[model samples]
Target: MFVEVGPDDFSQQALYDRLCETDRASQSGAVVTFTGRVRDYNAQGHIEGIELEYYPGMTEAALQQLLKQAQQRFALTNAGIVHRVGRLANHAQIVWVGTCAAHRNDAFNAASYLMDMLKQSVPIWKKEWANGEAEWVAAKTTDSQAAMRWLQETDEPGA
Candidate 1:
Protein backbone atom coordinates (compact mmCIF):
# COMPACT_ATOMS: atom_id res chain seq x y z
CA MET A 1 0.00 0.00 0.00
CA PHE A 2 1.19 3.51 -0.84
CA VAL A 3 -0.70 6.66 0.08
CA GLU A 4 0.22 10.30 -0.35
CA VAL A 5 -1.62 13.53 0.41
CA GLY A 6 0.29 16.63 -0.52
CA PRO A 7 0.54 19.84 -2.57
CA ASP A 8 3.12 18.68 -5.06
CA ASP A 9 1.97 17.55 -8.48
CA PHE A 10 2.44 13.96 -9.60
CA SER A 11 3.00 12.13 -12.85
CA GLN A 12 0.19 9.71 -13.50
CA GLN A 13 2.37 7.43 -15.53
CA ALA A 14 5.03 7.38 -12.84
CA LEU A 15 2.51 6.39 -10.20
CA TYR A 16 1.12 3.67 -12.44
CA ASP A 17 4.61 2.36 -12.98
CA ARG A 18 5.15 2.31 -9.25
CA LEU A 19 1.96 0.39 -8.69
CA CYS A 20 3.07 -2.10 -11.29
CA GLU A 21 6.20 -2.70 -9.23
CA THR A 22 4.15 -3.20 -6.08
CA ASP A 23 3.66 -6.86 -6.76
CA ARG A 24 7.20 -8.19 -6.46
CA ALA A 25 6.27 -11.85 -6.49
CA SER A 26 4.51 -11.79 -9.86
CA GLN A 27 1.27 -12.41 -8.08
CA SER A 28 -0.76 -9.78 -9.89
CA GLY A 29 -2.26 -10.57 -13.29
CA ALA A 30 -4.21 -7.38 -13.64
CA VAL A 31 -3.76 -3.73 -12.71
CA VAL A 32 -6.33 -0.96 -12.74
CA THR A 33 -5.81 2.76 -12.27
CA PHE A 34 -7.93 5.86 -12.06
CA THR A 35 -7.21 9.59 -12.13
CA GLY A 36 -9.76 12.25 -11.33
CA ARG A 37 -9.44 15.64 -13.00
CA VAL A 38 -10.92 19.02 -12.21
CA ARG A 39 -13.51 19.88 -14.82
CA ASP A 40 -13.72 23.21 -16.61
CA TYR A 41 -17.47 23.19 -16.13
CA ASN A 42 -19.46 21.97 -13.16
CA ALA A 43 -23.04 22.24 -11.97
CA GLN A 44 -22.74 25.99 -11.31
CA GLY A 45 -21.10 26.58 -14.72
CA HIS A 46 -17.82 27.88 -16.17
CA ILE A 47 -15.51 26.57 -13.50
CA GLU A 48 -12.05 28.05 -13.88
CA GLY A 49 -10.40 26.10 -11.10
CA ILE A 50 -10.77 24.55 -7.67
CA GLU A 51 -9.16 25.02 -4.28
CA LEU A 52 -8.78 21.75 -2.42
CA GLU A 53 -8.45 21.79 1.35
CA TYR A 54 -7.91 19.08 3.89
CA TYR A 55 -6.67 18.55 7.45
CA PRO A 56 -3.37 17.03 6.50
CA GLY A 57 -2.85 14.37 9.16
CA MET A 58 -6.45 13.42 9.66
CA THR A 59 -7.12 13.24 5.92
CA GLU A 60 -4.15 10.99 5.30
CA ALA A 61 -5.15 8.61 8.07
CA ALA A 62 -8.68 8.32 6.75
CA LEU A 63 -7.45 7.64 3.22
CA GLN A 64 -5.12 4.92 4.40
CA GLN A 65 -7.90 3.23 6.31
CA LEU A 66 -10.12 3.25 3.25
CA LEU A 67 -7.38 1.77 1.13
CA LYS A 68 -6.87 -0.99 3.68
CA GLN A 69 -10.52 -1.85 3.53
CA ALA A 70 -10.40 -2.08 -0.27
CA GLN A 71 -7.35 -4.29 -0.15
CA GLN A 72 -8.93 -6.72 2.25
CA ARG A 73 -12.34 -6.82 0.61
CA PHE A 74 -11.04 -7.14 -2.95
CA ALA A 75 -8.09 -9.37 -2.20
CA LEU A 76 -5.77 -6.88 -3.86
CA THR A 77 -2.06 -7.52 -3.88
CA ASN A 78 -1.22 -3.79 -3.80
CA ALA A 79 -2.69 -0.32 -4.10
CA GLY A 80 -1.73 3.35 -4.24
CA ILE A 81 -3.59 6.58 -3.73
CA VAL A 82 -2.53 10.22 -3.99
CA HIS A 83 -4.77 13.17 -3.28
CA ARG A 84 -3.84 16.75 -4.05
CA VAL A 85 -4.45 19.59 -1.62
CA GLY A 86 -4.36 23.25 -2.70
CA ARG A 87 -5.32 25.24 -5.78
CA LEU A 88 -5.79 23.39 -9.04
CA ALA A 89 -6.56 24.71 -12.46
CA ASN A 90 -9.19 23.36 -14.77
CA HIS A 91 -8.26 19.94 -16.14
CA ALA A 92 -5.67 19.46 -13.40
CA GLN A 93 -5.53 16.01 -11.95
CA ILE A 94 -7.02 15.86 -8.48
CA VAL A 95 -6.57 12.30 -7.40
CA TRP A 96 -5.10 8.94 -8.37
CA VAL A 97 -6.04 5.43 -7.18
CA GLY A 98 -4.68 2.16 -8.47
CA THR A 99 -4.90 -1.52 -7.61
CA CYS A 100 -3.08 -4.71 -8.49
CA ALA A 101 -4.68 -8.13 -8.19
CA ALA A 102 -4.47 -11.66 -9.47
CA HIS A 103 -7.72 -11.27 -11.35
CA ARG A 104 -9.22 -8.49 -13.46
CA ASN A 105 -12.36 -8.31 -11.36
CA ASP A 106 -10.46 -7.73 -8.14
CA ALA A 107 -8.28 -4.96 -9.57
CA PHE A 108 -11.19 -3.23 -11.28
CA ASN A 109 -13.44 -3.45 -8.26
CA ALA A 110 -10.75 -2.29 -5.88
CA ALA A 111 -10.02 0.80 -7.96
CA SER A 112 -13.72 1.59 -8.27
CA TYR A 113 -14.26 1.09 -4.54
CA LEU A 114 -11.36 3.33 -3.64
CA MET A 115 -12.68 6.20 -5.72
CA ASP A 116 -16.26 5.81 -4.54
CA MET A 117 -15.37 5.70 -0.85
CA LEU A 118 -12.90 8.56 -1.12
CA LYS A 119 -15.51 10.80 -2.70
CA GLN A 120 -17.82 10.57 0.29
CA SER A 121 -16.01 9.90 3.58
CA VAL A 122 -12.70 11.64 3.01
CA PRO A 123 -12.29 14.94 4.85
CA ILE A 124 -11.05 16.84 1.80
CA TRP A 125 -13.18 19.73 0.59
CA LYS A 126 -13.41 21.45 -2.77
CA LYS A 127 -13.93 25.17 -3.26
CA GLU A 128 -14.86 25.87 -6.83
CA TRP A 129 -14.19 29.12 -8.70
CA ALA A 130 -16.75 29.47 -11.39
CA ASN A 131 -18.29 32.45 -13.18
CA GLY A 132 -15.88 34.69 -11.23
CA GLU A 133 -17.36 33.44 -7.95
CA ALA A 134 -15.92 31.07 -5.40
CA GLU A 135 -17.97 28.83 -3.14
CA TRP A 136 -17.37 25.88 -0.84
CA VAL A 137 -18.82 22.77 -2.42
CA ALA A 138 -21.66 20.90 -0.87
CA ALA A 139 -21.69 17.13 -0.67
CA LYS A 140 -23.68 15.51 -3.46
CA THR A 141 -26.49 13.09 -2.82
CA THR A 142 -25.27 10.87 -5.64
CA ASP A 143 -21.88 10.53 -4.05
CA SER A 144 -23.45 9.46 -0.78
CA GLN A 145 -25.63 6.97 -2.60
CA ALA A 146 -22.65 5.55 -4.43
CA ALA A 147 -20.66 5.00 -1.25
CA MET A 148 -23.63 3.41 0.47
CA ARG A 149 -23.44 0.28 -1.66
CA TRP A 150 -20.20 -0.75 -0.01
CA LEU A 151 -21.72 -0.36 3.40
CA GLN A 152 -24.58 -2.58 2.31
CA GLU A 153 -22.14 -5.10 0.91
CA THR A 154 -20.26 -5.29 4.18
CA ASP A 155 -23.52 -6.01 5.99
CA GLU A 156 -24.01 -9.13 3.91
CA PRO A 157 -22.48 -12.25 5.46
CA GLY A 158 -18.91 -12.97 4.23
CA ALA A 159 -19.19 -10.08 1.80
Candidate 2:
Protein backbone atom coordinates (compact mmCIF):
# COMPACT_ATOMS: atom_id res chain seq x y z
CA MET A 1 0.00 0.00 0.00
CA PHE A 2 1.26 3.51 -0.87
CA VAL A 3 -0.41 6.71 0.27
CA GLU A 4 0.84 10.23 -0.34
CA VAL A 5 -0.67 13.54 0.67
CA GLY A 6 1.27 16.47 -0.76
CA PRO A 7 1.19 19.57 -2.91
CA ASP A 8 3.30 18.21 -5.73
CA ASP A 9 1.76 17.22 -9.02
CA PHE A 10 2.05 13.57 -10.02
CA SER A 11 2.13 11.76 -13.32
CA GLN A 12 -0.67 9.25 -13.59
CA GLN A 13 1.48 7.05 -15.77
CA ALA A 14 4.25 7.04 -13.17
CA LEU A 15 1.83 5.95 -10.52
CA TYR A 16 0.46 3.21 -12.75
CA ASP A 17 3.94 2.01 -13.57
CA ARG A 18 4.84 1.88 -9.89
CA LEU A 19 1.73 -0.06 -9.03
CA CYS A 20 2.44 -2.55 -11.79
CA GLU A 21 6.00 -3.03 -10.60
CA THR A 22 5.07 -4.21 -7.12
CA ASP A 23 6.37 -7.58 -6.03
CA ARG A 24 2.91 -9.16 -6.12
CA ALA A 25 1.68 -7.29 -9.20
CA SER A 26 1.96 -10.41 -11.34
CA GLN A 27 -0.80 -11.95 -9.27
CA SER A 28 -3.17 -9.22 -10.22
CA GLY A 29 -5.53 -9.82 -13.12
CA ALA A 30 -7.20 -6.44 -12.99
CA VAL A 31 -6.11 -2.91 -12.21
CA VAL A 32 -8.58 -0.14 -11.58
CA THR A 33 -7.82 3.57 -11.23
CA PHE A 34 -9.79 6.70 -10.43
CA THR A 35 -8.53 10.21 -11.14
CA GLY A 36 -10.44 13.20 -9.77
CA ARG A 37 -9.96 16.54 -11.44
CA VAL A 38 -11.07 20.07 -10.67
CA ARG A 39 -13.86 21.07 -12.98
CA ASP A 40 -14.33 24.44 -14.59
CA TYR A 41 -17.88 24.61 -13.37
CA ASN A 42 -19.95 23.55 -10.42
CA ALA A 43 -23.48 23.89 -9.08
CA GLN A 44 -22.84 27.49 -8.01
CA GLY A 45 -21.23 28.94 -11.13
CA HIS A 46 -18.01 29.15 -13.05
CA ILE A 47 -15.08 27.85 -11.01
CA GLU A 48 -11.70 29.23 -11.83
CA GLY A 49 -9.75 27.09 -9.38
CA ILE A 50 -9.59 25.67 -5.87
CA GLU A 51 -7.26 25.67 -2.90
CA LEU A 52 -7.00 22.50 -0.84
CA GLU A 53 -5.64 22.33 2.66
CA TYR A 54 -5.16 19.50 5.12
CA TYR A 55 -3.59 18.78 8.45
CA PRO A 56 -0.36 17.28 7.26
CA GLY A 57 0.27 14.37 9.64
CA MET A 58 -3.37 13.76 10.33
CA THR A 59 -4.25 13.73 6.67
CA GLU A 60 -1.65 11.11 5.87
CA ALA A 61 -2.79 8.92 8.74
CA ALA A 62 -6.41 9.09 7.67
CA LEU A 63 -5.49 8.22 4.08
CA GLN A 64 -3.38 5.29 5.22
CA GLN A 65 -6.28 4.00 7.25
CA LEU A 66 -8.59 4.18 4.29
CA LEU A 67 -6.15 2.23 2.16
CA LYS A 68 -5.80 -0.39 4.88
CA GLN A 69 -9.57 -0.73 5.08
CA ALA A 70 -9.83 -1.19 1.35
CA GLN A 71 -7.14 -3.82 1.38
CA GLN A 72 -8.93 -5.80 4.08
CA ARG A 73 -12.36 -5.43 2.52
CA PHE A 74 -11.23 -6.51 -0.91
CA ALA A 75 -9.00 -9.21 -2.35
CA LEU A 76 -6.46 -6.67 -3.53
CA THR A 77 -2.85 -7.38 -4.42
CA ASN A 78 -1.95 -3.73 -3.90
CA ALA A 79 -3.50 -0.26 -3.60
CA GLY A 80 -2.30 3.33 -3.66
CA ILE A 81 -3.48 6.91 -3.42
CA VAL A 82 -2.03 10.33 -4.26
CA HIS A 83 -3.96 13.39 -3.12
CA ARG A 84 -2.82 16.95 -3.80
CA VAL A 85 -3.05 19.95 -1.53
CA GLY A 86 -2.77 23.71 -2.23
CA ARG A 87 -4.01 25.76 -5.17
CA LEU A 88 -5.01 23.90 -8.30
CA ALA A 89 -6.27 25.21 -11.60
CA ASN A 90 -9.40 23.92 -13.21
CA HIS A 91 -8.88 20.57 -14.93
CA ALA A 92 -5.86 19.84 -12.72
CA GLN A 93 -5.78 16.45 -11.09
CA ILE A 94 -6.88 16.46 -7.46
CA VAL A 95 -6.59 12.85 -6.45
CA TRP A 96 -5.82 9.40 -7.74
CA VAL A 97 -6.80 6.05 -6.31
CA GLY A 98 -5.72 2.75 -7.80
CA THR A 99 -6.37 -0.85 -6.87
CA CYS A 100 -5.07 -4.14 -8.21
CA ALA A 101 -6.79 -7.44 -7.59
CA ALA A 102 -7.07 -10.88 -9.00
CA HIS A 103 -10.45 -10.06 -10.50
CA ARG A 104 -12.04 -7.04 -12.10
CA ASN A 105 -14.89 -6.92 -9.62
CA ASP A 106 -12.61 -6.63 -6.64
CA ALA A 107 -10.41 -3.99 -8.20
CA PHE A 108 -13.36 -1.91 -9.32
CA ASN A 109 -15.20 -2.20 -6.06
CA ALA A 110 -12.13 -1.35 -4.01
CA ALA A 111 -11.39 1.72 -6.10
CA SER A 112 -14.96 2.92 -5.79
CA TYR A 113 -15.07 2.34 -2.07
CA LEU A 114 -11.85 4.24 -1.52
CA MET A 115 -13.13 7.29 -3.36
CA ASP A 116 -16.51 7.30 -1.65
CA MET A 117 -14.98 7.03 1.77
CA LEU A 118 -12.17 9.41 0.99
CA LYS A 119 -14.59 12.24 0.32
CA GLN A 120 -16.00 12.03 3.82
CA SER A 121 -13.31 10.39 5.92
CA VAL A 122 -10.38 12.65 5.11
CA PRO A 123 -9.77 15.97 6.88
CA ILE A 124 -8.97 17.86 3.71
CA TRP A 125 -10.72 21.16 3.13
CA LYS A 126 -11.48 22.90 -0.12
CA LYS A 127 -11.77 26.61 -0.81
CA GLU A 128 -13.44 27.10 -4.14
CA TRP A 129 -12.77 30.19 -6.20
CA ALA A 130 -15.70 31.04 -8.38
CA ASN A 131 -17.14 34.26 -9.75
CA GLY A 132 -14.05 36.04 -8.48
CA GLU A 133 -14.86 35.12 -4.88
CA ALA A 134 -13.47 32.39 -2.64
CA GLU A 135 -15.77 30.30 -0.55
CA TRP A 136 -15.23 27.27 1.59
CA VAL A 137 -16.88 24.25 0.07
CA ALA A 138 -19.37 22.49 2.22
CA ALA A 139 -19.74 18.75 2.48
CA LYS A 140 -22.53 17.53 0.27
CA THR A 141 -25.25 15.19 1.45
CA THR A 142 -24.66 13.01 -1.59
CA ASP A 143 -21.11 12.34 -0.50
CA SER A 144 -22.29 11.27 2.94
CA GLN A 145 -24.97 9.08 1.42
CA ALA A 146 -22.52 7.42 -0.94
CA ALA A 147 -20.14 6.60 1.88
CA MET A 148 -22.96 5.25 4.01
CA ARG A 149 -24.15 3.08 1.15
CA TRP A 150 -20.83 1.32 1.03
CA LEU A 151 -20.95 0.67 4.74
CA GLN A 152 -24.42 -0.78 4.44
CA GLU A 153 -23.57 -2.89 1.41
CA THR A 154 -20.60 -4.44 3.16
CA ASP A 155 -22.88 -5.55 5.97
CA GLU A 156 -25.11 -7.59 3.71
CA PRO A 157 -24.23 -11.25 3.33
CA GLY A 158 -24.23 -11.32 -0.46
CA ALA A 159 -23.09 -7.77 -1.08
lDDT of 1 at 150: 73
Q: Which stretches of candidate 1 lie over 4 Å from their true place?
A: 154-159
Question: What TM-score does structure 1 among the candidates reach?
Answer: 0.93
TM-score against native, each model: 0.93, 0.94
Off by over 4 Å in 2: 23-26, 155-159
In model 1, what is the error at residue 115, expressed in angstroms? 0.6
Q: Write the per-residue lDDT of candidate 2 for residues 46-94, one digit (tens) a residue.
A: 8999999999899999999998888888867899999999999999999
Per-candidate clashes, comma-separated: 0, 0
**How far out, in Å, is residue 133 in model 1?**
2.9
Clash pairs detected, candidate 1? none
For candidate 1, the 10 contiguous residues with the lowest summed lDDT are: 150-159
Q: RMSD for each model, in Å, please?
A: 1.9, 1.7
User: For model 2, where is the 10-residue window of minimal lDDT?
Assistant: 150-159
